[model samples]
Target: MSNIVALVVIRVALDRDDQQLRRWERKIAFGYRMFIGLYALAGASTLPVAWLIARASFVSYVQSHLLYPLVLLAVVEGCVEWGLSRLRRGRHTLLIVTGVLLASIAIYFNPRLHAIESILLLPILASVFFLSPKKVWLAGILAMLAECILYWLNPFHGHESGTTPYDLITFIVELVGETVVCHGIIARGAEIWEELRKRGRLETELLVRQIVSEKDAKTDALTGLYNRKSFNEYLEFALRISAETDTPLHLAVIDIDNFKQVNDRHGHLVGDDILRRTARAIEYHLAAGDFLARYGGEEFALIIPEMSHEEAVAHVEKIREKIANIHHAELTTQHATVSIGLCTYVPGEDSQALFQRADQCLYQAKKSGKNRTIAHP
Candidate 1:
């Protein structure tokens, strides 16, 4: 029995945690899609500028070289935007390959134009959106290395060329500086994402803990019913609402008949079983909108909203009959019964007054040969 209860509690907590995690994933995925859309748009916008520059220069070599790869990159971005899973499945390699090919073609056309090497930074920056710090670092380093090889292989190197060694040195310095800044920004974003996940998990845990605590505070540990404290608070609240709405409130105070004799004959453990069984039997007879609580030792209280005095008496009588017919194996006499006192609350009356009247009826029921219901005159 205890194991079943523990499993239920654990399942509830796990369900809450899973819900929180899914919410975070949805937010991150949304942001990632937006980033991809902007990136694709940026690439598409650059095509017009590249086209005009190539046409004015009348350099077929530059025009063909730049146009083919820019179009290919646009296609690749579309694939990535439509299916981000492709990025995780190694399709990101297509992006890196396109970037390297474009840089190599530019360098091949004008080997001495060291400024063109800055184009390599595009692939490095694109990898930052992957949210993987290691991927970003690796892409940046590989891009720099690829540029270094091209620089050494340039045909005009060491010649009296327009591009001097100082230009190459300055380009490398700027590339390294930009890579550092980009890496720091990407790493910080990853940290912030992780922190949001942690905060969500903590908040879920706190909410689950609060629910469990509130339930425990109101429940009777032994009978598995609302305890006396909960009963009092609910009764008062119901009275106030009924008064405001002009609705009738019916209250029944039930006491187990001969409960002490059962305890003396069969021991307290068996008596406890009878109490629990009797509570279950009474609860089965109640309908929706009715409140049942363990009011005291071997006693329970029921609150029926929107019921008149006659209807309330009939309801309590049914519960009394049910309890009288219940057979319990743990009871020495093989049967148990309850005496119920029924009363309808008067409008504008305090809860204490209502309870006192109910108590008086309960006393009268006990006095007049128990196991029957008594309603206030």
Candidate 2:
């Protein structure tokens, strides 16, 4: 009982403040249904015990013991049907009331049953599930009152001719103590659920914030491309793995043609737009194993791995031509073109040597004419 009630309380409390409470209410309903089932099963057990007792004639025992259980089972089932209907409609309190009623019936109907006083606690536990002090107190008092009434009406039910004042006091203490524990379990369950929930939310928020912070550190804010520092680290790692595994590598550096003249004639915003547009254009043509980064103010670096020499040159030419075709109305008529320098990596070549060769090709491309590519063998 404690385990079921505690689970229900914890789940409902944790999910209540979130939008998921509606879904978890079914768990609460399930807990109540379990209580109802236990009550019914306990009541039904009396039938077999009554049948086995040979003290009375079969007809007499059937009249005294068997008949009442049959009637009680019918009534309990009726109450369960009514309660469950209300439960389906989200009236959870109906099940709690039904459990209390059924448990009471189980105890009173089986008068010759031993230790009947212990059964009084079932209703109190059900009432305390609400986590309301007043509800538990009211339930405890009413239950004690009802039990006293039953004992008074049937004095032979106790161990002696009647219950003594000491027995009465002992029952009160036990009832109060057990009721307190039931209340505490539910209240404590809610507190534990709340603490765990708060910690989970804080952790999720910190994770997201950390992810965003790391991205800002590694990427260009304007172009949303990997910045120079990230590109350097990526290239260094790519080179080490390529040399170890004998994978081919090609690196290129692209500089926008007449970028300074464009910035001088237009403005920084247009320059920024051109840079972003060029990044997007390069991204569209890149293969799965390609890496592109904004290496400087007007320069972008690209690394393509596991491609043949011919495929690399053809791809770089395609990107260069795509950049040369970008038309801007704000530029008044002149189109922006990019000059690229391409080189394949030697088997054991360091990053610096490979970059130097690509940079030299960039120098050659500019020396020959502005808008073109220079490939270094």
Candidate 3:
């Protein structure tokens, strides 16, 4: 019971966000439910023991003290669990009330009859789990006060002191020492939990930063496509895979027609805008698994896996038609067009040789005319 109550109090006191509280309320309530069920079973089991005991004093003691207080404790536990489940008000109030009742009962019963005041540990320890440190102090103070009041009202109060006011210096010292130890334990545990959370947050942030850095390294800033470095690396990997598996892979190099004239007539910014738009248009025509990258200034490289030489030509020609039909009123009177050269992978060919053949086909396309695809035989 002390562990469960203390944990809840700590959580509630530390909670600063309403959304987090709402999220945790159901789970927190489960602890309280378990406490109530176990306590109720304990109360019920005592009845059989009370009935079987034939001693008059034992039966009387059990009936007057044990059974009644157990019943009250069970009721308090039930009320607390209900309030927690509903997430309603008076939850904390019930906890405080329960603490006071437990303290009073412990002092009254005084199982050992040696320093009944030490029973105050029940509420003091329980309240330490609450969110606020203030509650812990409060619980200790109230428990001590209740014990003192009961002591004063007792017929045996002065009997132990023998005509002198009871000197509680020893008890007070012990209480202070125990309370400090409890706080120290709580403080240490809280520090460890906070440090772990901080470390976890930092690790998550570093992982995210690393991912973004890798993406930027592989991407072209101007066209937002894979840059030349990434293009070469991807081609090398794709060529190796093709060679090993004897899979069909097609490569294409595309260049904008009259690109130098467009840059000469207009500023570089306008030319850059045209290039970005052209990249988007070409990218739109590609299917999934096809790779496109900015190979150099005003040039793009493409790779299509699982395609024949004829299929590769058809794909590049489609992108050429799309680029040719683009109407850019801001830059040129005629629409921008691209010349594409496509070729299929030869068995066991290296990346450099494959790319060189594709580049030769592109040169042939440029020599033949602009705005058309030329395929290597």
Candidate 4:
């Protein structure tokens, strides 16, 4: 019985583990979809503005290199959105990397378009939304560095044009504003994401623990089978189903014959071992629709759905033979045997009446001599 209870506990643990893994997978997929949609929308909104700026800018090199790359990034972002819609994990990362690379190359070639640093906001948000906090911070740092490098280069011939003090102050203020806003947003998003991840993990752990606790509560400590409480619950549910379907049900009460003698001869420990082994042997012969529960010390109850009295009796006989064949040498005992009492379900009968009839048969089995089965017609 202890072995059976252990098996039930293991099964519940495995099921809970599987459920948690699925929950995490779903959260990741949801986050990925949100990233793709937001990026695609941001890219679409920024593409026309990028083109207009490029047309108005004085640097021919900036218009050709920077504007073209921005448009290409918009296209890649759109493709990533479509890939996410199709449930593809691979295409999303690929497009994000490709877009970032193209944007970096454009900035490196045409430092004059440093005014377009506003575009960095998209990458900063995307990195934080989809990647870890560390990666998001790294992306933000890289954007800041790129802007500073472009500011120093002053590639639009602004340095040669002898930039005034007012222009320099305005440029510095814009740079600081852009960096502060983008960094703040990305950092805040990262904080929120981390909190959510922590909560989700905690919830999963709590749910698994609760399931295990409930399973343990329903299980018998000694025999590893369903205890009386759990058995009663199962019996009630089975009886209800049988009544609804108009199917026959069979109940059997089994007692270990001469169990007290075994305990007296071999000590209580050995006797316990014998009880566990006997329960296993009986379980091995049971059909899938049948269930057995430890009813108390040295006694077990079996419920077989859709089984008639004759069939149940025959099955009990087989179990008696199997028990007789079981070697009790490990327990330092001579022989181990079980006596069974069988009763078939009657329509509109309660559990008490059913149990009483089976118990009466058990008394008859013991009176006729132990180690045999008695059936109630």
Candidate 5:
């Protein structure tokens, strides 16, 4: 039951793919196996006390149980691991646990052995541990039947204490009551598990869809740069921060020279390749604090922060030169050029006015000569 909860939480948090979920599931399975091994060790530890109570030497107990719990541990661990690995059915595992616990009880079944009946709870617990209600009932029934048969036919205790019908009835009622309670608990836990699993899946699906929608809304499909809307939002943020911090900010609009002719002659595929390459070139020249966006077709925008006017100029110039030098294989020996218009932000200047100023500088660059950087004074 706890494993189910852990699985649901981990899947909700990290299950982006089937492979990732399987990794977590495997880890949980291994943890459950270790728990079973520990349970076996814990159960086997009570053996020496039972041995001493039987007036048997501890050495005899050790030898009888096979070298100090090692053999029992190996057997229990082997049975559990084999069931977990080879058998996917819950009833198969239930039977295995029932067998192991019943065998343990039978091993210590003697007139002198007190409270050996407690080991029968192991089957019920193991079933409850895995959160299987039907299996819990099966284990409880098997444990009661085994107890009745062993107590009825035991040669060591012929009509001894706890051998009467009333006592057997009481034991049966207790076992049945515990099993019913465990069954109910597991049934209720199963309901809660289902509810949480469904909720986690719905929430995860919604989160994933939201993430994809956000990406689509903010990023250009062609060049993977920020779209115009994202750029506008970022520009407002950059301007506000620059004013508040008294830091300088530069804005630039870059236009690819002869883009229409390239699209007309080389085709849209080659034009798209050129656009992607141009975006990469500009991005390669950018610092960590700089921002680049696909303003629109054949045009790009950039925002540079925390830089002096000279540094901004040198940065954009490097970009302008890099684009001019790209030799696209799709265009053979032909090349492309970009004209850049840059403007430093004035404190308290509105975004539209600042954008217009950069556009005006771009017009100047286009008019004077293509492939040149024009800065607004």
Candidate 6:
């Protein structure tokens, strides 16, 4: 019984956590349909047997009283079905509660209504399917109270009233049987729901971790820029776009001036700081539609799509000036500067060809002097 109760509680909790309420609605509809079908089948199977027993006992009053409450319960349950179909969360709760209370009262009042005890099954099913764990607990409390009241007001009790120990035993057995069956169904449903929810949460977490891993693979750790692999991919994409649009593209190769010297003078830590600061300055000076990547070591590459050789050179000069102006707090030595080599795309040119031209211009910049931009036609 405790295990069953725990399962029901878990199902109720899953229902609340389901962000998409359509799932909850479908569950409710299926639960109600099952209840209706099961009860209808039970009624068809037992009504005739009950009628025959009542007639043999010379108790025709049993048939009329029992039939009346069953009809009323069926009607109330139909209303609950309709309410669940059309209503949303809070409104659905109200309708279901009203239906359960009506059925409980009707069963409590009818003298021959021991047969109507099946009405309680509907609420138990609803508690599992639609209501949350908190609501299931509340419904359990209400059902217990109703049962106590009905037992106290029962008019068939007494040794002299032709009622024997067998009759009392039968009544107690029926009550316990109904309670156990209803509670068990709800509990099992809840357990299945909780297991599914746990699996769903785990799957979502795995998906998030997978996405973060992919992002990390493509990004540089130091500069927070695209790494060499991503840079290659972007360069291929840019070349394709430039070819399609028949637009001239520019490639710039930038190298920090005497980066090894900075490392030896200030320490590797300060050198790393300077690299980060220079990357930021370069990023700040770049125009929209321009992209920069950490090519390798202390070198970076820029792709300026739809720009001519002269325009690319001007942009690279601005980046060089920006790097020269960047003040690093950890730098106890001289200011940092960068040199750049710019080249323009030609028809049918591949990434290697463009990189070679840019490298040649970069070599020229280093030969002429550092802290400058050199361009190749």
> Against the hidden reference, what TM-scores do the models get?
0.66, 0.68, 0.69, 0.67, 0.68, 0.64
lDDT tens per residue, model 1, 1-377: 44554555567666875665445434434543454455346545656776777766645544444455445545644554455444445544444444455455545555654366777776667666656666666667777777777767777767787445786677767777877888898889889977875676566566667787899999998888999999999998999899889998988899998999999989999988998898898889897899999998998999999877788888889888988888888766778888888888987788888988988899999999998888984
165-227 in candidate 6: lDDT tens per residue?
565456555545555665676577678866887776566556556666788899899999889
User: Mind sharing the TM-score for model 2?
Assistant: 0.68
Instruction: Name the best candidate (by TM-score).
Output: 3
In candidate 1, position 211 carries an lDDT of 80
Q: Rate the local accuracy (lDDT) of all candidates.
A: 0.74, 0.75, 0.73, 0.69, 0.76, 0.71
Off by over 4 Å in 6: 1-99, 102-120, 130-137, 147-179, 186-191, 308-311
lDDT (Cα, tens digit) per residue for candidate 3, span 53-75: 75657667676556676666567
Residue-level lDDT of model 5, residues 96-176, one tens digit each, is 353545344444433345665666665676566556677778878887887687666655544555456776677778889
Q: List candidate 2 stretches off by more than 4 Å.
A: 1-51, 54-112, 115-200
Cα lDDT of model 4 by residue, 83-195, tens digit = 64575445334433543544454455545443544654545555544434454555556655555555566555356543344655565465456556656776786687568
TM-score of model 4 relative to the true fold?
Answer: 0.67
TM-score of 3: 0.69
Q: Write out the backbone clash pairs for model 2.
A: none
Best candidate, lDDT: 5
Better of 2 and 3 by lDDT: 2
Global local distance difference test of model 1: 0.74
Clashes in each model (backbone N, CA, C under 3 Å)? 0, 0, 6, 5, 0, 0
